[model samples]
Target: MFNKHGTWPMKSSLLTRNVIILSMVSFFTDVASEMLYPVMPIYLSSIGFSVLLIGILEGVAEATAGLSKGYFGKLSDNQGKRLPFVQLGYALSAISKPLLVAYVFPLWVFFARTLERLGKGLRTGARDALLSDEATAATKGRVFGFHRAMDTLGAVVGPLLALLYLAFRPEDYKMLFLLAFLPGILAIGFTFLIREKKKERPGFISKTKFFDFFRYLKESPSNYRKLLVPLLIFTVFNSSDVFLLLKLKESGLGDTLVIGMYVFFNLVYALFAYPMGSFADKWGMKRIFVFGLLVFGGVYLGMAFAEQIWVFAVLFLFYGLFSAATEGVAKAWITNISHAKDTATAIGTYTAFQSIGTLMASSLAGLIWYSLGPEYMFIISGIAALLIGLYLYFSKL
Candidate 1:
């Protein structure tokens, strides 16, 4: 679908080049982000921040993503350009890392962390919209899956790099944070490689104003709206990965083993994402997503019952499979069902919902854990997924 300077000897091959470039950008940026991410909670804990402060900080950091994701997404559609926002987002996030490394104080760290969320909000929707622009209907699943795979591979590499650096410089958190700047810059630089296709503005709509975030949702097809209900239900139960890591730590797992478990999870995610995406193309996104929900149900059920370390490991691996089936595959489906003009807006709305869902998931899970027990949190979450999966299947949506 993309014609970049007479390149591409084959149509299908063009998809590879574009997706791979995006993948590289995702890989490098994730490397930059994840390097600091794992370090944050530890750094805060070291500086004698309270768990309450840490919880509040984490909530603000993640929820800020919802604040801007939709706004930037709509702007991309209105302007008919994607690269500028993507580059700027990466730059802001990249710049924030060095700032965090230099100033480890509470106030400075707060701003830096919030800045990172802002960057994610700005870049994600626009970048996803661009990916959709390049892909044909037939290739959407594979393209999105490939992008997520590449993005997650960086997730795999980032923590390992952090772990290796920490192995040498155990107390040098600043150095680890500072080194993140390099990959962040590389990720921003890679944005130059993407070649975006232009679309003509519709005659009825005014060109002066763009990005009507809420109205776009009101006008979106029933499919998009229907899909959101189940997704929102699932997201409300799917809490932060931090909770999973924390569960392991509470169970007396070492820091190194905890990091290792995360790496293993990402590894499984990276391996399965592409294959799942291709399968979604052949079968359907809804069907595969239901299957993923079943996987989630199983993993959470495992978490509820398992008391052993090995059981947690097995559950973590299965959790990766659930992520592989959902993340990119959902975006690809949204791309197909949405209007061409509102594609970016649709993505923004979807992510906004996800951010809200994640916020609810974490807070509610904590409530459940405190009220009943940690095991009850996962048991309730598993049941929610099971009920929703049945709704989706019988509803035949």
Candidate 2:
């Protein structure tokens, strides 16, 4: 029932001006981020970072982003504004790219990475709230799904750009990091095109305590909690995708092929995100999400046994489907169940805990990878996903 300018003009078209512009912003930002993503692990390895250290770096960075998401999300709600947060967040992220190579010290690398993720934290709730405000319960899937598709399209272009560059100059990661800044700036520019509807502050302004966002869980409807519980549980088993790339590398694939697989996975993701969202709307968000989990279970289980390059390709293909099915669909599902006023807070709190879960997941996965081979890690994750999928399928929620 939220509409930006009064009545919803989106009955005929879901891709309103704000959604397109925001999606463009996401598209460019992702381009910047993903350009570095496929190379990060390899670059760290070249600079003497062990797998364990990499895990810790990702964990710490994500934790920073996660915690800030809650605070900033709550702040946005209190202030009844989204544009400033979105603008500032993208600006921080835009500048953080070139800083990645400003110095090669491990602490500096951690600092730069955390700064970038912090930007993500700053904007996630506000940005998503804007998207939610543009759509109704009926169209949340298409709106979010379209945004994700556009965002992930950048994921495709980014690595492909990196791959092309690396093809010419194989180890020039620093220069590549510097180049990523261009797309980031473009993303920032797109942010200016976005205009939010003015909203009055609630009668009860929430305090801006760092952990205050967590209180929403108690206040939220049962359905919100029910949906979140299984998703968060699933997140614990789902480590960073970096681990997947590293696994391919450990299996003896070269950098180019590893990155290529990543690109292909994203390509599949970009292609299917919108369609999957439409499917969620037509069928049920919960049903599509459960199906995505089943696909994820299959992909990981397949990764457990696969040794051939072709096998890995097939798995990555399915992995993309898993991403398509779940990512935006989950957000749409949450927005549907949450109170409209608390849109940003609901997502921020969920994502903050999700970030914490990611920290745990990445750290745990790293420990498992260090102790027992990747096979065991993949198997454990696969089994856990399958179990969770079944549980969700049977649950009444």
Candidate 3:
């Protein structure tokens, strides 16, 4: 069992200071990120960028983050360090957020978003690996769930802050971007305080050959083909949240109201995350995960046909609940199948595959939305989700 200090121990508290600190870090960072999120698409549209460009931009950003996560995670593990990378990633994202606001050009916005995603890619695997290290086996579900809850809590508060700012200074997006810097800096500081426990390193491994890394993953029973197949299927239907946001816009909701609805979604996510995780722990991870998949499919289908803003908002809330049921719990499930030493690598691999899924889904959804219209995109996504869910159910994974 892992302890609060990220070492093996017989007994430990579910709510440790490190967990709280990490939660604070996530909270602040989400606040910074969320402030810019709602307006970004509108801002791009305002600047005369097409939906296709938006699709490409979002896809590339996510793919970059997803692909790099494993590499950075491995680097952190190899160096026996996490704080420096974590701090650097946060700093880069912090700098990028303000830059996007200051430089309103479309290409500049793309670069800024890409840089921010790069920071995310750099930090996520390492950070989650650290959380796994810090959590005891018995409370892993709750600990990860709590972290996600806190993270989404930040998401909840962030939009409200943005809403408040927009209320007074509606056009000053640049100011909101500038203000985002404060929380990121605080996150960096908190990262520095996190303690890294020592672990025995295996013999020297070459980093240049990427194929060898795949071979390593394949050879390890702890993280081989068994668990990966189901996850891959599930991810194929899991597109970017941008689609859902666009669906809201399609429902004829105003920008402020759309953001308010998003805030509501995060509120539901934050409220239910821990309790759902505990329930998953009791029932089974696979069971809850499959349920989330089904819920996601149903929500997408609802988005396709729903004409009312209120209906869309409720669907969004259920979408948040779906997230609460899965995100961290899925990671916890991965950790259950992986050994401590390769925790980051396994997470990185999982994230990398997830990125592939996002890239495919987002790019496809965008094309469908532009060519066939919004209705077909959700219809296809729902169909894909149903197929994946059926596969999971039958596979019994």
Ranking by TM-score: 1, 2, 3
TM-score of 1: 0.93
Off by over 4 Å in 2: 1-12, 42-54, 105-107, 204-206
Instruction: Write the residue-wise lDDT of candidate 1 on 315-373 in tens digits.
Output: 99899999999899999999999988888889998998789789998899989988999
TM-score of 3: 0.89
Clashing pairs in 1: none
Q: Distance (Å) between predicted and true CA of 43, model 3?
A: 3.9
TM-scores, each model vs. reference: 0.93, 0.93, 0.89
Per-residue CA lDDT of model 3 for 110-129, tens digit only, reads 89989999998788877888
- Give the candidate number with the greatest TM-score: 1
Off by over 4 Å in 1: 1-14, 201-211
Q: What is the model-wide C-alpha lDDT for candidate 1?
A: 0.84
Residue 260, candidate 3: alpha-carbon lDDT? 78
lDDT of 2 by residue, 179-269 (tens): 9999999999989988798887678764689988988889989999998999999999999898898889888999778878988999999
Deviation in Å, model 1, residue 158 alpha carbon: 0.6
lDDT for each of the candidates?
Answer: 0.84, 0.90, 0.78
* Candidate scoring better on lDDT of 1 and 3: 1
Residue pairs with clashing backbones, model 3: none
